[model samples]
Target: SGRVDPVTAARIGKVLGVDALILSTLTTLNVAEVGGISVGPLTVKGVKAEVIITGRVVDATTAEIKDSFEARGEEIEASIKVSDLQGLSFGTTAFNKSVVGKCIREAVENFARNIISNPDRLMTHQIELRGKVVKIVGSKLIVDIGSRSGVRERMTGKLIRMVEVEELQQYVSVPIGEVQVYSVNPDTCILEVLWAEEAPMEGDYVDLISLK
Candidate 1:
């Protein structure tokens, strides 16, 4: 199960009730000895472990690959014995402390950072949701939307404040700022304001902008 095909991804998505899925495969894992190399005043020889991973974001409903990325990790141990790398099983404490395990961890970390930095790349379609700013503390804004409303972490929204037009005698919804959800609950979600023209207040409206 190193690779998740489109059909398998779709089936898993349906069972998990998710709109999208991220599939990753370990493309390469290698351990090589670096022959003695000059390092300033001394020659250095070491064992190097390298790992390469490929990742994809698939639209569960359409079974389409929306985005793809690659990450790599490498670790080198100077003046080390190759025997130390042998007989190491996956997930063991000793293995985790080994160079190979560290390489894998770094690769996964790189993958996560890549996804977090490019959120729009994961969007297969748009969804509309509206909620209210129920509370505020410092720069944190609490919204009414929650997991029950299909809300998840990392979702972003625009805060709208109503302005009364003196001449028109009507209230208009004006976008004041933006916020990204960081925490979620069954009936509520907490957001950190990204920016604001005016400080957000309770009773303001929220227009959902991004899906988690």
Candidate 2:
């Protein structure tokens, strides 16, 4: 609501295949030199840096605020030797972004620790996959989910198919089989069949359910 707009929430829901979503926001990520600095022929430059970062967790569907956190970082007062106080045009001293990066990391990690496992946060490791099986090799079931989709070794999935019954007039993707990731590439993953009610044939549906 405050951060995730309707279009963004819809797009994210499509990707996650979930009716709800947990949203994280970076409210503040800023860095500045607090101490005074002497420029151009005056004198020296003082280096006292300050960083502030804030994070907020929200529910995309309910438009509710779940949690919020703040973290701060600072660089102690230091001296930067001036090569040329009165340079012709530009000097070669550049402020480093790493200090601000540290602050952001602290803020984000703190936020994750506080809210990731909370029941109200609605966080899950589940990954939704929608693609057809390409081929099979012995007990191995290879699919189109791979590094790009965050697939890794030892990850598992459930094989399902939408079947229709003339009497019921509805389609369902039942857990016909279970599979484990054996190997993976950038855009492909090889899964080893663990159990199946019936042998899975080519062109079947493969759902790499989750990473955690």
Candidate 3:
């Protein structure tokens, strides 16, 4: 019903459990007749249509615009009588088959191609999964992040141990090992330790690896 602001779009994206929201605007649209051409007994003109769209990728958690792009498409219908376009209107079957429709469809396809070709920035970078280790039993560890945080079985994370840095006068995380999710619940998940330099203990942290 109305244009959504970036913050609202981000809020909606979060509610939908999506990493990003795509915001698109119609930057330009034009339809006009080009010069006419003669073919035997008839003089026909070309009707040209152009469509341009501007797209933005908004990060769901941060409400930040991560990327922006522009896509354009054009189509020309040759040998067409100007009288035949009198009733053309958007969303009608006649309009959809016209030059403008094809131009819009092509513009959308270009937008999809742009996003797919640059997946590292638009898709892979949006995941943020990290939580503290709550419990440990035998070879398994329970982590605070679960299905609610987009956790799934087989997901892996690197375990981090808090080590005190005497010189820095602070505690810092050291990568101790890795663990893979074995099962998931609403607010927690069970993980099987993959490998570790030292045994991971409770209160350690884990950072989920982003899927490629």
Candidate 4:
């Protein structure tokens, strides 16, 4: 919802049935013009500029901003030439043309490695496909994720097997194993289990994942 305030978040939560939502914002992807002629006699021209990026994560329910991260790239346009525009120098076109491409790539790469690579960082909320393990023969698993859910061969994800908690009268996911899509049809797929804590059985949960 617009602005992500309490009222907006509450409306969203009402429809989605989630108390708190993880929100992420890109605070800055600065692209300031840095090179030109000195506007005033004391002004500097063609100075090197840093490529900077910052991200913030917030809790929607309480409207509280939580974790923040930043990444700064190396100074670009280390060398500069005074504009050739007879006396009146203006835009940074000439300077930016030389380094803007490389600067942006470095900045984004640094940001991802420093900030988004954490295990507990932003996670996808989209549920494309979810199915149950209908059958298992040795290390091979049969799941319901297939062409209907856009699943393809070689795709991989973890199998979350459900375990009934007798004391709590509820069910919880037990990590069954990592699985790879080996074959797919219109309605189902066969998976090859690469690793498992316990042998997967009927009724284990299998959720599809995106490579992106």
By lDDT, the best candidate is 1
| Tens-digit lDDT track of model 3 for 63-122 | 899889999999888876556678889888888888888899999999889888887556
- What is the number of backbone collisions in each predicted candidate, taken in the order shown? 0, 0, 0, 0
On residues 1-212, what C-alpha lDDT tens digit does candidate 1 reach at each position?
A: 56579778978998998878889999999998886756678889878899999988889888989888999999887776777788999999989899888999999999899999987777777776788888898778888988888777887878889899999999998999987888989998888888999988899988876444
lDDT, residue 151, model 4: 87
**What would the per-residue lDDT of candidate 2 be over residues 1-212, giving only the tens digit for each residue?**
25665457656766776655545445554444444545655554444434455544444454444455565555433244223222323222322333344444556566566655554435434466655678888888778768887787887778876688778988778779888889889999888888899888887887776523
* Candidate with the larger TM-score of 2 and 3: 3
Ranking by TM-score: 1, 3, 4, 2
lDDT of each: 0.85, 0.61, 0.84, 0.64
Ranking by lDDT: 1, 3, 4, 2
In TM-score terms, candidate 4 sits at 0.47
Residue range 70-160, candidate 4, lDDT tens digits: 7766543433542332243233554334454456557778877865477344332334467788898877889876887778888778888
The alpha-carbon RMSD values of the candidates against the true structure, listed in the order shown, are 7.4, 11.8, 7.1, 9.0
Alpha carbon lDDT at 181, candidate 1: 82
In candidate 1, list every pair of residues with a backbone clash.
none
TM-scores of the candidates in the order shown: 0.58, 0.41, 0.55, 0.47
lDDT of 1: 0.85
